[model samples]
Target: MKKTPSIIAAALVLGAAPAFAGSATPAAPEPVIEQAAPVPFSSPDWTGFYGGAQLGYANIDTSAGGDDDGFIGGLTAGYDFDLGQWVVGGGLDYDFADISIAGGAADLESVFRAKLRGGYKIGNGLLYATGGYALADTNTLGSDDGYFIGAGYEYLINQSFSVGGEVLYHEFDNYNSSGVDVDATTVQVRGTFRF
Candidate 1:
């Protein structure tokens, strides 16, 4: 009778092994995460040094009763500082021309300018106003000091190249000691390479 009880107890423990394992709690599964994508395009940086050229027409009128128009072309260089929504710069320009006065009185030969510019930033460009001092040269009338004011717009084709246009009004009270007033209007197309 003692041997029978011992055998029965061992059989009961073996049979309960699978049930005990199943009754215990199972662990939770881990989570899966996804990441977001990045943007593709951005705005341009306008602060730099630049050199360029321009070509256009000039209409000249004089107090001596002469009026005429002809070609004007020039090279320019400048440095610009970008200030958040604004940009400012200073530059120089030298233009060559040979527009005649009506009745062959004189030929306007060339002009040199020292310029200051400031503008509002618009997309990939600037809408700006410019003014400066200028020296006007003529074949017969000699050279004279003058002032000019203008407005322009510049657009970037890329980071390194830009194109623009301007309209300026220039005035001189005396033409090289001749006591004749001169006024000029100029329109130009400009191209630039930036560094």
Candidate 2:
């Protein structure tokens, strides 16, 4: 009878062993796996202010039978606003020249301009059209008000620098009140500093 009781006790202990094993802290939960989050997409930014210099050639034609050509150079400053694929801006420039009239009657001295430009952006390059008011000065005849229109292309070298070129046509009627109509075409290579 004692052997029977001991056997019964052993069986009960064995049965309780499985129950204790099940109740033990669950095996550490399976390692969790997570995916990395996606990155955001964006476009290039090009809104700012700028300033620069230019050097190029000027060819002049006069209604009074005189024509001439020479070198011109100047300073420029501007501001721009970026609009997705397009940009618009305003600029001002002043150029000094020493071009003489073909007939030795006078010399063209300087030019000043206030301009507006609109451009299309394509892979770091800007193709634009510009037009505005101009003032032409002469060494002898005086200075006169004029207008100019032109096209240009500028490439961004970085966040603070750019290079470009422009070709403009200008008209000064009855130049400096001397009863001479003057037409000038200027081609310039430009370098700019942006802020």
Best by TM-score: 1
lDDT of 2 by residue, 41-111 (tens): 54355689899899999999998887799999999999999998999999999999999973778898999
Tell me the spans in candidate 1 whose CA falls farther than 4 Å from its real position. 1-42
Candidate 1, residues 144-177, lDDT tens digits: the string is 9999999999999999999999999999887788
Task: Spell out the clash pairs found in candidate 1.
Answer: none
Per-candidate TM-scores read 0.79, 0.78
RMSD to truth, every model: 6.8, 6.4
* Candidate 2 local Cα displacement, residue 32, angstroms: 18
